[model samples]
Target chain A: MNFDEIYSSKLALVEDALKKLMERHKECPPTLFKAMNYSLFAGGKRIRPVLLLSAHELVGGNVEESMALACGLEMIHTYSLIHDDLPAMDDDDLRRGMPTNHKVFGEGMAILAGDALLNLAYEVFLENAMKYPYKLERHVRAAFVIARAAGLHGMIGGQVADLEQEGKDVQPDMLYYIHTHKTGALIEAAVRAGAILEPIEGDVEDAVAKYGQKLGLAFQIVDDILDVTGDAASMGKNPSRDEARKKPLFQLCMAWGNRGVWHGT
Target chain B: MNFDEIYSSKLALVEDALKKLMERHKECPPTLFKAMNYSLFAGGKRIRPVLLLSAHELVGGNVEESMALACGLEMIHTYSLIHDDLPAMDDDDLRRGMPTNHKVFGEGMAILAGDALLNLAYEVFLENAMKYPYKLERHVRAAFVIARAAGLHGMIGGQVADLEQEGKDVQPDMLYYIHTHKTGALIEAAVRAGAILEPIEGDVEDAVAKYGQKLGLAFQIVDDILDVTGDAASMGKNPSRDEARKKPLFQLCMAWGNRGVWHGT
Candidate 1:
């Protein structure tokens, strides 16, 4: 298969796995399950999970062994979106062309839903690791990489910085910190975790890490640029909110505008 | 040492471990770090961690080996408290005789702090587990137990139920469900995780589980009763709020008022 064929096939597998995982959780309260499912099944492109699976395949790692990790990465990504749209955060009313979790389920359940998703992500990771005890060390290592990326030093750290820098003149150093930590960390984790599932060869893991870091930053810059250039219908969410809220945008920074030259790294 | 001495020593050790964990993350944004530290070091008794250590000792689990799990449990407990006090949730202004996390750090930071703590908890657990690769299976099992207790099947499940049933006339079964899931799950998980750290022998694990469930239920009932009987000065927060909000409370249920009889299984 070519790149698109492999990507499409991997995406289908992730969707199937995620659907089964949600079905298993239907015994919880109807509202909570629905709230989680509504967002999980919302028209996300499954970029992070796809990245993980693709990277795993690139390294000749067993795709079956890394399925849970990929699904868990998607869950972490979803939970962050749910929390980010809360009234205290970005207060977004729409996500992926649907009402946000808080808008549909109310703020309290949305908050709990996000918490539950995060908890369930770890639950899924640990459960899968326990099932394959011989490979438990690799699973633990992968989970640690993902956890650190999702925690203070990674995604959440970037979010806090972004929140603080909102509507203020942000230094270039701070802008890089916010973008890299917020958007880049988890993306980097996806690739590194995929590669780590197989034993590391000399320089392979380091090269994979560098690739992930660059991919993550490029992904965020493109996303910010889309917010400036894309329309609401195509983007699913309103493209103007970030600019209206005066968020630190790559397109707005004149000092860093030399498109092909990476200055702040 | 007697029970009191053992308890105090364990408590001291947990506090120290938690403090060090917080100190390590000072490189994150200052507001985020302070928000997390504020709620973490709040003056609540370290009941969950103590329960874990006590149960570990009862099962002859290595105390040194279980330290990270204890601190991780505390982080989960703290994160739950921070989220529960959000304006979207209980909206309380005070916790443990001081301002709540959101009140001090603003709602966005508080939310991120809670997310950071939860992510950090898993990080600590995985990091500790990896250090003892030979014992990795046991750590995975224990972590799975905690994750389930904190996820939709346990604490978050109960919280959702409680939110849905608020200010409504609830049946005894629903009340029991809410209490068991919301408060009892983590408490039970504490004992179970502690015991699982060591290999189980015979009926001991079953007996420990029963003890945990009953103790958890009893602990919550006593807390509800304290709200009715104790003063705000003693309780550290307003005692009237739960009743004002018409939350389901054990003291308000008349059908189960025969104090000696266990009404629901």
Candidate 2:
């Protein structure tokens, strides 16, 4: 299959898994679930989960085996988006042509919904990990990479720095850290996490992670470039929103596209 | 050692672990870490970690083996408090005579700090679990219990229900579900987590968990009773605060304590 066909098929697998898992948990409070589901099911490309499955496939792992984890990644992404849109954060009202979680449910329930989604992400990962004790070590490692990548050292760290640097002069290194970390870390981890599903050698793992990193960096730069070039109606988000905020997002892209996507020599 | 001495020693171990772990993450932003540490280091009895250690000991597990997980539990509890005291949540300013996380840091930072703590807790758990793969199936199980207990079906679930019921008539079943889930689930998980550290049988695990459930319920009742009867100067916060909120908190205690802590036969 071509890239679109392959991506769509993998995306279907992730969606099916997420739907079944969520449906199983009927006990989750209705209103809170509504808020969480609102964000979670809001249509997106599911790039992270698809990337994870592709990486898993690249390293000779089954999509079925990684289905729960793939869905879990989407949930974490959704939760981050929900929190990021809160009044204290980006304060956006519309997401993907729909009202954001906070907008529909109120900020309080939105926060709870994000919390629930995060907790459920781990639950999904752990539940999947529990089924395969013989490979418990790898599953634990995978979960760690995902959580750590989305964690303070990775996403949250970048967020803190960005929030701190708001309306201030941001240095190149700090700005680089913000985009690569805030956006790219988890993307890198998703690919690396998929690659590490099976027992791979150290050099191979390093190479795969490096590749993932380059891919992640490229993805972010393209995202920024899209913001400059893509139409608002199609992109669903306003074009040049980041540049409009007066941050030098394009410098990093120019630096990368001019030099190769990967940083190391 | 008496209970105090033993408790203090274990408490010291948890504190040291937490300190070392936090210190190891020096890369975390200063402001964000400051907010997290403000709440984490604020003086309160380390009851959760202590219970974990005691339970681990009761199940013949070494403290060193469980130290990381023990500290992880406290991190989760600390994160809960930070979020709980947010302006949108419980809105408490002073916790243990010091400013709450949001009171010290702005609301945005406090939220991030709580997110960081919760993420860190799982990271700590997985890091410790990674050290010994042979016992990982059980470690995965233990982590699942903690996550599940603190998750939407447990603590978060309870918190959501409580928030929804605010300024409304709270039925006894709803009240019971709130306390048992909001407070008791994690408390019970702490005990069960320690019990499973060494891989005990099903019946033993059940009995230990029962003991934990009883202990947790008793603790909450006594906490409510103390609010009605205890001195404010010693309690460090105002008594009857829950009552002042116009909730029949003590009534549940009176109904339970006057009868029995556990409702299930």
Q: Interface RMSD (Å), each candidate? A: 0.7, 1.0
Alpha-carbon local distance difference test for all models? 0.85, 0.81
TM-score of 2: 0.94
Q: What is residue A165's positional error in candidate 1, in angstroms?
A: 0.9
Candidate 1, B106-224: lDDT as tens digits? 99999999999999999999999998887889888888899999999999999899888766776677877887889999998999889988888747877787688878878878877
Model no. 1, DockQ: 0.87
| Model 2 chain A weakest lDDT span, ten residues long | A238-247
| Residue lDDT tens for model 2, B13-71 | 88888899899876878898888788888986888888988888998889888888788
Off by over 4 Å in 1: A240-265, B244-265
Model 1: chain B TM-score relative to the native chain B:
0.91
| Position A105, candidate 1: lDDT | 95
Instruction: For residues A1-265, write the lDDT of model 1, one tens digit per residue.
Output: 8979987999999999999988887889999999999899997888889988878888898888899999999999999999998989988888899889999999999999999999999999999998777778989999999999999999999999988977677767687788889999999899999888888785888778777887877787777778778877888886746554345463435534543325433
